[model samples]
Each structure stands twice: as structure tokens, then as C-alpha cells.
Target: MSTDPTRLSRLPIVQAPMAGAGGPALAAAVTGAGGLGFLAAGYRSADALAADIAELRALIGAAPFGVNVFMPHHTATPAEQERLRRYARSLARAATRYGGTVGTPAPGAERDDWDAKLALLLAHPVPVVGFTFGLPDAAAIAALKAAGTLTVATVTSPAEARLAADLGVDALCVQGAEAGGHQGTFDNPDDPAPYGLLTLLALIAPETDLPLIAAGGIMTGRQIEAVRIAGASAAQLGTAFLRCPESVASAAHKAALADPAFEHSVLTRAFSGRWARGLRNGFVARHEAEVPGVYPYVHHLVSPIRKAAAERGEPDGLALWAGQGWRLARAEPAADVITRLVDEMAAARKAHA
Candidate 1:
């Protein structure tokens, strides 16, 4: 089989694996539209992930699709844990307003069910598997390759790209700083590289022979063409699909993306302990300065409050993750979004040619 990642789909577009926003319906819709779609396995139990995979397969049949998993990393230190606890305490007043209570800091035990999910993928053998937050070890990579899975590693820097290349990954999803949700900086989640998607692609392309998939702040067909010209084989977009009808994003989240009042996206560790870009809201404004770098701990601490906010349909309290070009995202069907992107990309390329 050809190792070319682009060959997996008829279109050069790839729907990003956004944990909460993306699901089987959205994935199937994109794949059915001739683009490669991805089902995010982050924040899901092994059983839930298996169900989603089965559902996606049932819906799309043999259409090419992918799964993205969060590679586990231990980022919380003792000092960070103490700071997280203090931050949790500070949020008591806000939590009380939503009838929610912050939880105690527990970092080490959270694996996001990595082992079981990997075992499931190995046994079932998906078309493509991508990792974010960090790269899996060589043994895991070899095992997945042995199972006929095309493995992709998300990288933000040339150094990280080199490490992934050494492990022989099939491709690199070069995520830039402007990407929505979490920045996939494996070494230091607190401090991500300041480079843009095009710049990161420039830096990483010469370092490895792996196919590159550009992600972050890419919403228009022109932007996709620009990335392809810069050396990416494909473009991966998350926020552009958040408002699609097939997306599983919360109503508050979808509304926030279109609300002119939300104004701008700010990269903050307020919602999840790790750095993520989201539309600025009251919660972000109040807590961005005080939040610690203890991921999953702070993530758990803020869960109930976010849940309550979501239930109440209050955009101010929920994490409204979006890319910089969020203003360009439209409310439409997932298939329409894919078709428009593909059409636009062709037009853009033709105009340049």
C-alpha cells in the first residue's frame, strides 16, 4: 500500500479531530463528501470510543477516516499541584453561582484510558491514527504499523518533528499556535512555540521526509492553497467545522463562534490546565491570570462549572474554543462545508496557476 497520506482522501481537506466538537456523524459526513474525517478519542472511555468507531464504520462503510488520540504526558509538578489547589479554592464563589463545586487536584492517575483505547485500535485496525499532546513510544508506533494503521504525530516544532520522524511516523500534523483548543506542544504545554502554521511547516519540512498536514487558523480556500504551496500535503481545520450541523459541539459553543460580542480568541490555561485558544469570556477574563499549569487536574476542577454553564446556555461560563478565523465559520451542513472548501481550494489553485 502507498504510504501517501493524501491518497486516503479524494479532497485535500481533513476535518480535525476536535474532542467535544467532532463525533461519528461529523466524521461520516466529511468522509462521505470525499474528504478525510477524524473521530477524536480524547476525553472518551475505551468503550465509548469503540462505539463511535463502530458507528462511523456503519455510517461511512469503507470510506477513508481517521481517529485522533491524546498521548498521555505527566505535566503536573508538586508546586503546580499546590497552585492548582489554590486556584480551585479561588473559584468557589464562581462555582457556587452555577451550583457546582470544584474538585481536588489529582493529576497522575488520569490516563484518558490510553492503554485500552490503543488495544481496541490494534484489534480493530482503523485506516489512520493520529496522536496529539505527545508522540507514542516506538513500540506503540511499531505495533500500530504492524496492524496496518497509518500513524500520524502532531508536532509544533522542528525538534518535535525530528523526534517523530525518528520513530517512523507516517505523517506529521503540523499544528500552529493559532489552532483552536489545546496547542499540541509536547515538551512544554505551558509555553508553545509562537510560529504560525506556514512558518512551522517551513521549519519542519526540511528536517524529515514525512508528509505534512497543516493545521491552525486555516478557514478559507486561499489559506489551504497557501499551506500547500508552503509544503503541506493537506490542510486540517477544526473551528471551521464547529458550527456545522453534524458537529456535536454544544449549542452555547456554536452560538459563541458566531457572536460578534465574543470579539477575540485568547490563548489561556483557564479552562484546561494546558494552553488552549478560546473566545474571551467572563470566566477566561477572570481566571486566565491565576490558573496553574496542572492539566487534567485543573481540567477536572473546571468541568462541573463548564457543564453547568453549558446546561444554562450561558456562553460566558463555557469554554468557547475557536481559531482566529472563527468569524469566517458558517452554520451549515458538514458535507456542504467540505464541498465548499474543496471547491474553493480548486478555484484558488486555478487562479494562481
Candidate 2:
């Protein structure tokens, strides 16, 4: 597959797509600066996503932008869902501490309004597209390509990268072991691919010729150039962008991101069923073991309590997602940060020379 014509060349950087962090302004800023930015649509509904797209258009002209969708899974059975409900109830004391009540999973499951969202994207096609959790079926991917959307799928291993290449994706996002949020593992959430980006690139280079985008604990420009030399076309960052002024991160989330107290993060299914890395705070420490492999179930189990905690500034109950190199992050203008990252990469290459 050929590279997408609409992709950025001025800057070989992708503003890490962040969910719930004012996506429109961040994406528009990055795109405006000649790099790509993406909005995380994981927890958003179709109507909300449509509104976000409108906001993005208002902020940035018909410039290139990307929206990432989390492929939804079938919800667990009633009993299983109920079990999650009981699990939420078990956290009552913690909820009360934040002046919140635990919530039950809504009565039914929604596909994150997949068909409608797809229809919306097809109607208002963005310049770039990516999917996580899982790739949409071939028919869906084909539809996006037909509408002129450049497709990229995130993968954790060389085997998965080869699968995306064979399936005809234009590029692959090689997310290494240290990435925050979900791991994009095609297999089990618990069974994360342990390979770091350097090792992953070495393993994948021989398998597929697809252009790669490297992601993980890529803090400094040195790490970015290392990935570039290791065979990636660009680098994507999440934790680094969490503190940007344009981000929609809550005060609590931002505070946690800057907090020296929360020194480490772990992969936990306690917040969401999928394995995600985040600051090792009160919540993960208390319940990671109790969370079941059942996703929306575990996700449902913790939704209410998380919200309650957030509403009251209780960081302990909120999901403070951050990568390993989060401490290296600095608060700055999104565009400046992007420009700096490009310069840093260049500097790293120069120093080596």
C-alpha cells in the first residue's frame, strides 16, 4: 500500500490522540503546524463525536485531522454484568469518600454507535484514520479507503504488523510495551507483547515493508530519532500531550500527571477491562486483582466510582493514565511542543554524527 498523499511531511510527528482532552483544539493545532493530530473517540457517542468534528472544523479549516475509534466488543451476559455491578457496590466506601454513588452498567450495550459513526466519517471524511482495540472488518476498512481516508492500525508485535500489512493498511503504528492507555494487543489484554520499541522494530523490519510509526516511552528527541533510525516513519506521543494547554484533562488528572507522589504506573484491568498503563495510585493498587477479564463488565463496574471521584477532585478514584516517561513531560503550547520534538530529533541525530 502506498503512503497516504494527505499525510504531513513538514513534521514527522503525530500529536498523540488523547480521549477526553479537548481533542478539537489540540488536533487542529497540530494539523495547523504541519503535523497530524488525532482525537480519541473511545468513550464518546456518535452525536458527541459529530459535535466534536464540528468544533474541529470551526477551529481549523479543511486541514487534515484524524479521529481514532475504539472497536467495541459484545457486552457480557446479564449475570456477568451484574457481577460487575456488585463489584462497583463493593467500592461504596471509596465512592462515599468523594461524595459519589457507585453506578451500574447501563441496561444495554451500545456499539459506541459504530455504524452511525462510520456513516458520519464517510460523510465527512477526515484526512487520516486509525483504529485500536481491534481493526474493523475488511469491508469497513475498504469503505474508509474508498472515501479517501488513509488507514493505520496500531499493533504490539511483528506478527500483528504483518497481519495489518497483509490486510492492506497503508501504515502501522508499532506501539511498544511502555505505552500508556490500552496496549492495542490483538490477543488477550493480559497477554501484552513484552517487546520494547527497539526490539519490536528489529523483529518487525524483516517481516513487513509497511512504513512504521513508533510509540511508547518515547520522551526525548533522542528516543524519537532512535525509532526513526530503527525504521519508523514518524513518532506518536500521548503522555507528553496530556499536559498541553489545549488538552481537556481535568484539574485532578493534570495534578496527578504532575504529582511526585504517584511515581509509577502499571497495566491494570481494574479501570477498564483492557490492559492499560497508568499512574499507580489508590485505585489500581486496591483492585487490579479483582477485575475480571470481561471488559465492558469491568469497565461498567468502575464507571460511576470514577466519575464521582473526578467530580470531587479525588485523584484516588480517577484513572490517571500516563506513560512511564510521564515525568519527563512539560506543559507547553501544543504547536511549540511539536516543533520542539522535531528539533530534538534532529539534534539527537546531529549529536550522533
Candidate 3:
């Protein structure tokens, strides 16, 4: 678990923390390979997150791994609340497909349990910690550093990179608009302007000396080498690993990546309220227009539906999160994926050199 950015450059492979999809086995397999693996702590309870950390620690035997946390944000407005209510009512039809009712939106109490998670991490630290959605407070950052955790912030723009750097994060996971799942944008805009990974890396590289972990639509060794040349120390891939045997991504999700009927990925807030990339489906088509820009509220509203869909092995209603490069994903072992990536990266580097 070296802190040197150069070490990251040497390995240059990081698995993105995919909530629901990524678990200890996937993280362990990725870490067991040369690259770093991260456990997603976004939707899990604090106790569940702790159990994951302990399990990962056991499997890896003190190897450096990461846990990604979602930062808290401002609650939705009155107008947004009204929209949420409407949206919840609309989901009633979908809920019946799963034999469950639509979830009630508790906007007042919608949260990820940030404090309890922070306390959990502080008391029992892991090797690495990353944050998405927003930057944690300075004190929290300082506390993590003091506890010997390497902090990384997921940023989607040069401005966001600057903010994370100013907050003293050791690295920036520059999440391009092509990224799957959530945008990691601080504000969670209604319609975010797209930023390509290479463009973001070029823009932020000149502004700060922090190591950049390039994410979004990266699924190959050539892409990894490309990011390295663009000034990123490493490449973090989530969609690429979703198909791996160790990944906990639903069978439907893994199948959807290669499914001909599921033509492409689209950024929709229908499932979670926040803009996230997933395969276009009947659910998105029906509900995308009705979703409000409220987070965990929308997330809660749709949870029951997603669970029912998963139980039924239905892809249409599940959040089949995938990046732009979904077509390039493979069904394989996690170690094999890393091996192929590293070999490909080496070839790309040599050819370019």
C-alpha cells in the first residue's frame, strides 16, 4: 500500500466501486491481481460496510484496497418533493410486476448515514477510501489521513478536481460523463454537460499535480495506456468488471451488457433520481420524463421495484449500469481480466514508444 503516485502508475489498474455489483469477492480478486480493488459503500448500512471491510481485509491479508462512500447533499425542494410524490404514484404499475408496492419517499429522512460510516471508518481504518457525489468536510479528510488512509475523490470536471485537490485529497478519480452509475458531480445538476475522460484529464492535469485516476468508458488495455499518456496515473473501470465471474452484478445485468436487444447505454435518473448511465430499457422509457432531480428519495422509491425485478431475473426494471463501452465487456474471471489488461497496456505502451 504505497502512497506514491508512481506506484499507481506502475500498476495502472483500478476497479470502480459498483454498488450492488461489487462485493468483497470481486474486490479481493481484483486486489489479488496487481491492481487495486474498491468496495462500494454507497447503499449499504454502516454495519454492512464494516462487515465488507473486515471480509476484504481477511481475504487480502493487509493488501491495500479501497472503499467508496457517497457524500451527503442538500435535500430536495418543495417542487421537487411534489414531483417525487407524482413519480412514486406513477411507479405503482411497475411495482405490481414485482408483487410489491412502490416505496414511500421519506425525503425528510433520506440519507446514506454519513456520520455513522465516518465513525466506522475512523475507528477501523482501511488502506484506501474514496468519495463520490461530494467532497467530505476538511476535518473528515484530515481524520482519515491521520488514520493512514489514502483518500481519493471522484470528480467529473476540472472545477471539481480543483475543489477536491484543495480539500487535500491524495488523488482524483476523474469520472467522465461516459461513466456508468452516478455522475459524482457535487451539485447533481438537472442536465449535466458531458465531459469526456481524456478532455477532463488534460484540463485538470495542468491545474494540479494530484494523481488522476481516469474512469468512464474504459474497457481495454489500449484505453488504459491512452489515459496514462493523457496524464492519469491509473484507470478505474466498473462496467468492464461487471461481467467478471467474481462480480456480484445481477445475471440480468451481465447478460444485458452483451444483449443485442439492449442496444446502448443512456444517462437516466429514472431509477435513482441522480443521473446515472445504464442500458436503455422499458423502465427508463416510461419513467425518465417523470423523475425529479432528488437523490436517495427517488432511489428509495424505486428500490422495491428493482429488487423485485432482480428476483424475477428481469433486466428491464433493474439498473443495468454500464458505460459507453459496454459492448467491449467480457465474461471471465477477475484475475484474467487484469492480466489481459496489463498485457494489453504493455503492448500499447511499447507500440506508442
Candidate 4:
């Protein structure tokens, strides 16, 4: 535990930067409770992300927290582009079923404003910055380091871990296949075979000197202790905190986490082009096979339908991203969640010792 990030206040617990679920309130609450917190910058514009950074700073002062951004994605080929168009047409039908319409798939609309967001982060440096989907250029990494920001990369394989280490990232968030939301693989393979969390940690730990933060299906204090024993400096959890009162996860999402009808989580590309873990629902069951591996385009294509589903309080149409251990999630204050985790972690460590 001596390798814990100096910026971390006390515990080695880190709240995952969950887009659409975590925000300033949740991040601040987690930080206030003696753990590192993070804000997801994936879906926000440069100005919107900046506003969040400003608000978090006002709320927590100089306390250490992190911001995560989805790296600029790869360009699609002609065949893949055609698939995107065809996929959009099918989604149009799906949208109509929900009494909604789908968004137009513009050629270059998948861009996440990566350049401006990077510029904003450089101008207003934060305690930590994490990247997923792809690696940042070496120069950008250098600039962030020079600005006194620690960098973390989310990697699903040892090859990706070595690549991030070569780029001078200070830490690696080792995401397992069980992770909620999108798998942080650099390339969206036609078929993915991801390592389980413990298996991934074992493979990546000996490959690099950089700290490892284990993520995926971690919902209990014993799980946290287990990851630490496997050589992780900390544990990052997203699904575990989804039901917290401060979390911005929708009522439907919160409810589905605890709902008996959900049964189990599955990896599906129906919501977005990228593979992600979420509760199996009618939408996923119907469209998983038809989904292309085309990222933000597919993501944008389903935006309107998802919005309509949210407005109608329908769980089936929304992406109910959750980890395997989602059944253990508790709806409580974020601080209490942290405290319970700490207490449970302590008990686990003692019992195992």
C-alpha cells in the first residue's frame, strides 16, 4: 500500500470515472470520504468538461481527484462505413418501435473534440488524468507531466500495458472483461477475448513497474483486499457505486441494478459499436447480432432512442451498464459506501492475515 498515489488522501479505493453515471456530486462525495474520486469526460464537450472541472475544484478545493477521457478513435474503412449506414437504417426501425427517431450519422461526427479537451486539460491541470480507447501521443503525455499531472491509462491487455508504459503513463487501470461499460481495448476486434480481472492483473503486474489499478466485477471489500494482494496499488470500481444516492445514474438504471428480472449481465455492442457489459434487455437481445463495431457513430445513432427510453422510464431501451457483481450494489450515501468498504476491507485483511 506504500505505492498508493501520493495524491490519494487515505484509502486505496478509486471511484471509476463512469460517463452518464458519475459526476461532480458523486466524485466530491467519494473524495470527501477519504478515497480518490474521478469525473468522466467521455461524453462532454471541452467547455462542459471544463465547467465540471471548475465545479469539482470549488467543491473539494485542492483535493486530489481524476478526470477520464475517451481517446480519439480510429477512422473507419469503406466497408465498415457502409455497415454503419446499414446499421443506422435498422436502428431507425428500432427507434420507431420506441416512439422515437434516431440521430443522423454524419461522416465525422464520432469525434469527441479530443484536441480541445486536451488543450483545456493542459491549461488547467488536474491532479490526475486517465485515458481509455487509445493512447495519447507522447508529446501530449509529456506536456501533462510537465504540468504536474499524473497520467493513467486503461488497458485490457499486457501489450496495451507495455505500450502505455512506453508512453510514460504513471499508472495502468487494468480492466477485466467483466468491467461495465466499454472494454478499453485500443482496437475493436471482430471478436474479443478479454482476461478476467485477477488474470489480467497477474499478467500485467510483472510486465511493468508502473502501478496497477484493478477494475471489473469488484463489488466487495474482500475483492478489494484480494486485488491488493495480487499486487495492485488500488482498486477502481464503477458498478459498485452506481446505486449511490449521489450517483447520476438514471432511476431506471438504479432500479435495474437491484431488479430480480435482470438476471445477469452480458457483453453487447447493440447500445454502441464498442463491446460493453450491461444487463441483457429486449434491445440488446434483439440487436446484439446486428450491431457493427463502428464506435461513436453507432453510439450517436442510438442517442435519440436512448433518450426517449429514459424519458419514458423504460429500462429495455437504455444501456444498463453493470458489472457481474451488480447484485451486491447498495443504494446509500456515497460516504457510507466508502466507510463500509473501508471497514469491510479492514476486516478482510485481518481475517486473511
lDDT of 1 by residue, 139-220 (tens): 9999999999998899888888988889899999999988999888885555555578888898988777788999999998
Error of 3 at 232 (Å): 0.3
Candidate with best lDDT: 4
Per-residue C-alpha lDDT of model 3 across residues 243-340, encoded as one tens digit per residue: 99999988888998988999878999999988999999999999999888888899988988998898888998999899999999999999999999
The TM-scores of all predictions, comma-separated, are: 0.96, 0.93, 0.96, 0.97
Worst 10 residues of 2 by lDDT: 1-10
Q: Between 1 and 4, whose TM-score is larger? A: 4
Worst 10-residue lDDT window for candidate 4 reads 1-10
Model 4 per-residue lDDT tens digits across residues 114-230: 899999999999889999998989999999988888889999999999899898888999999988999999988888899999999999998888888999999888999999899
The RMSD of every model to the true structure, in order and in angstroms, is 1.5, 2.1, 1.5, 1.7
Candidate 3: C-alpha RMSD to true structure equals: 1.5
Instruction: Provide the global lDDT of candidate 3 against the true structure.
Output: 0.88
Which residue pairs does candidate 1 place in steric collision?
Answer: none
List candidate 3 segments past 4 Å from native.
Answer: 5-10, 105-109
